[model samples]
Target: MAKFDLKGLLNDRSVPDRQQDQKIVYRNPKDLIPSEENFYNTEKLERLKQSIKLLGILQPLLIENRDGKDYVIAGHCRRKCCIDLLNEGNDKFSRVPCVYKTSSELEEDAGQEDDIVRQIMIIQANCYRDKSDWEKMTETLKMENLVKELREKAPMEGKTRDILKDLIGTSSGQLGRYHAISTNLCEQLMSEFEEDRIKISVAYEISKLNKEYQKQACELYEEAGILTLDDIKGLYRQQEAEKGIPGQMTIETATGQNRPPEDDTEIPAETQIERFYESTNKNMKNYIIQEDKNMTIFMLSNLYGTARVRNGHLNYQGTTAGITFNPGRVFEHELSWQSLAKILIGKYGHKKPIKMVSVDIPEKPKKKDNEVSGPAKCITGKSKSGICGAAAYCDTEYNCCAQCPDDCNSRCGWLEERCQPAAEIPDEKQPDFVEEIADHPGEAAALPVMKNNDQRKEWLRNYKLWGLWYEDKNIGVKYYKYDFENGACLIAEEYILPGTEWMPEHETAFLHLVGGPEPECKGGIPKWTYHARYYKFPNSETELVEFLKELQK
Candidate 1:
């Protein structure tokens, strides 16, 4: 019998146009290099090992040649199992079946094009394998980079997301959630999420908090065995509330004429870029722009998106929006730092107000004539001029200043704090009221008829019956019809709507808010007008009652 030429067979398999019926050949397990990437944990790896021992390599491995080495591509775990069995004196397992991948079948793993193609192949090959959320998220992020490159290299192929969807079975919305979770959540929380201890939706919300707050939320979850949106929101509200507490030291307190300084030492001056980077990194690390190789990557906080700057061009992608801009020149000025930030916000802010991220110095608060009286103790004994000479409190053990005296020249660092711009409240427009009511609902009489705008606003503010409220407890209703000439107030105690994947839209009562200035006809005959809107949220009294009950528990 003619000797079967395994060498010739393997060599023939490397040819691009080789026969379709490629035969599998047995090779020493040591000859094949295990794949570098490993997503399986020890438990899963052990299970794979046991399965291999039982099944005895029923399926052949896929191998590719790279730099004169046979590298395992799809069957990393199987190759590992063979090697383990061979090490245990199982001579039968020394040689395992593998099919050589053709040159045309796999990319050369060189250059950017090769890198993207290689990632797509690996992701598709492992699609059948059971993966953790973290692993899927990791693959999704890799695919995101591949999508960007593919778009740049082949702009006319298709939409970026459609290409990504083909490469990896993930929607654009899901990719955003994965990106947010991976970028913002702390390591502990991420691990918990990966291990299935936390839900992805809950994890995404928790990612909005800083690392410290994430850790706190994680601890709460551990104790309670459950974490909800309300819990996460409560923690967020607590964090924001701590920022502007009453009597708390403000930027004004440090630099004010009568407020004590944090310390007598002078802080070194920071450049605009350094200041912007430091403040953003400290407060909102997710939004902090990071330098990578020749490009910079920045996050769009409001839009939950990301963008990159390279070669004097900007490329941005978000959940609901995308943009590309080329200024024809690289930004080199200090002011360009802030200008660039504003440009990103303006394009992707989705009509939201601007974020105060620039390094602009805040205006100092005006002091009241009777805000403080009498001589105060200086907290820092060592002032810029000399020793502070306020009072005996300077000599006290605390050595802290109760307040800076009127004549004290000590420079306060309070002037350095970033100030949020005052919220702009637009003047309310009065609605044209109809003199006669045509078909007023009986409930319209129950609602107080306010004569003026202030009374209307006050009523809306005090309204606890049903309305969209702000996230912050102190802030009142989000939507109000101040100028509304009430035509009807319909309340649905129970609602049945189409259910979504997440949950039903409304299980509780909601308002069928029908109030707005009726469309007017300047010179035409009178006709009844009805402006109706639906509010399904949060505006429910039953929900609030249930929430309060849960809080009491």
Candidate 2:
């Protein structure tokens, strides 16, 4: 409980005799110590600097003589302005006008209790300037700390609250709020509230929640990018909803065995299933498909049993020995060959069919636009050539599909036959393709991509999602880890400004998406060749799909 001895410093009465006239002395501005209770305004400081440049110090600074140095009790800002001007090589500001206080006069003014008098003087000096609520709260906490220390030495009854009210010029109720904020709120939330990122009213409401709930709400706030009063209200509602209590009721009515009211807003089981499938498909399209060749290979291999190049014609292996047929004719009974032909034409172009005896066709020449030549290389460490092949197409690279007696294509033949090439589906016709995938029981669907502003807003609102901030250089790139719950813990790149204020326009891209699915198999993790890095998210796959779907909207 060690504290600075304000009483001893202010109460010392012995002093050498001096002239009675008040004298102004020129002193180095840097020697003046600013008052800790004083708040600095950048704008005002700039204005003050300009004024001093145009006109010399009109009034001398009031400084207390302490330890052979000047402690500025008043005109701190003006002294600061002079100091800055001096630093810029302005000779006119090299020495500032200051009036020093005599120890004998200060002691005489203190009366009996010097510590209380000293506190009153400090408060009175700052009272003329308007202060923000945050600033007031900060000052109040300092006074309370001083009072607590003094009370330990000299026990006082109800004088603490009254003294605080008088010093801060606020009512007991307002002082109570300041005390609660200082005592009850966590350090991080307090900082945010002080920075204007959080409203005082909203902060007070949050202070009411338990520590765990408060932490969770903070997490939600960071994830949502911005947290408003309405957002806080929504969170409270969600918490109540989770507790199954939207309203209060009489004990008899609550205990009575009556059918619960039907909820018209509840999503139907079928609709939820459909949405899940749609979301899953969208995610696949946005993140899973790495190459046009891979998708084409997937579609073709799924449709026809191991496609092979035989004597320059595209054909499918037949069940009988040495027998093969054109893929168009083999699935002609089930599919529209004309649409399939058009997809092939769009993807491979209308080139003359190549002639090859073995199924292993020579690798096609590299694509012109620097696109990936084929399916993603298998990283499972199981492939013979270390390149992904037909075997790598199963649900898991480590194990073959359990449902397939022979191969996945044979078992899931119906899915392949019904599926259309991704390229063939026009932008407007893509929804139908997703519906078709949803109709199937076990097919992996691609997730959607975020396309427009409205969709982005809706997605952000629905999932409370925040975009990742990124900066890339040739040598390396940086990723910012935003912690919504405890903003003080944010790990960001140097370029990002400090604070939790959400700026959607400043968002570069989403990375390390939390609440997304893990790779189905080891080494199945997605890879990007672009000159950028991403963090891995460890959230559930179901939540990831829903999150991505909203992002896609």
The prediction achieving the highest TM-score against the true structure is 1
True lDDT of residue 448, candidate 2:
32
Clash statistics: count for each candidate: 2, 19
Error of 1 at 416 (Å): 99
lDDT of 2 at 130: 61
lDDT of each: 0.47, 0.46
User: After superposing candidate 2, which stretches have Cα over 4 Å from the reference?
Assistant: 1-22, 35-44, 51-59, 102-120, 147-158, 220-225, 237-553
**Model 1: lDDT of residue 216:** 90
| Local lDDT at 346 for model 2 | 36
What TM-score does structure 2 among the candidates reach? Answer: 0.36
Q: What are the per-residue Cα lDDT tens digits for candidate 1 across 1-553?
A: 2222222222343322341356788888888886665454434577777788888887677777789988876777777777887888888888898787654422332224665555555565666678777778887788677657645653334565665666567898998888899889888777788887777878888988986788899889889988888999888876655678776554455568545333322211122222334434332432332212112233433333343333211222222233223212242222233343543233222232111111111332344442222122222323321112332212222211323333343323232122111122211221111111112232322455455545544444454444322111111112212112233333332323333332233232222333333434447832233334433322323323322232223
Worst 10 residues of 2 by lDDT: 352-361
Q: Which stretch of 10 consecutive residues in model 1 shows the poorest summed lDDT?
A: 352-361
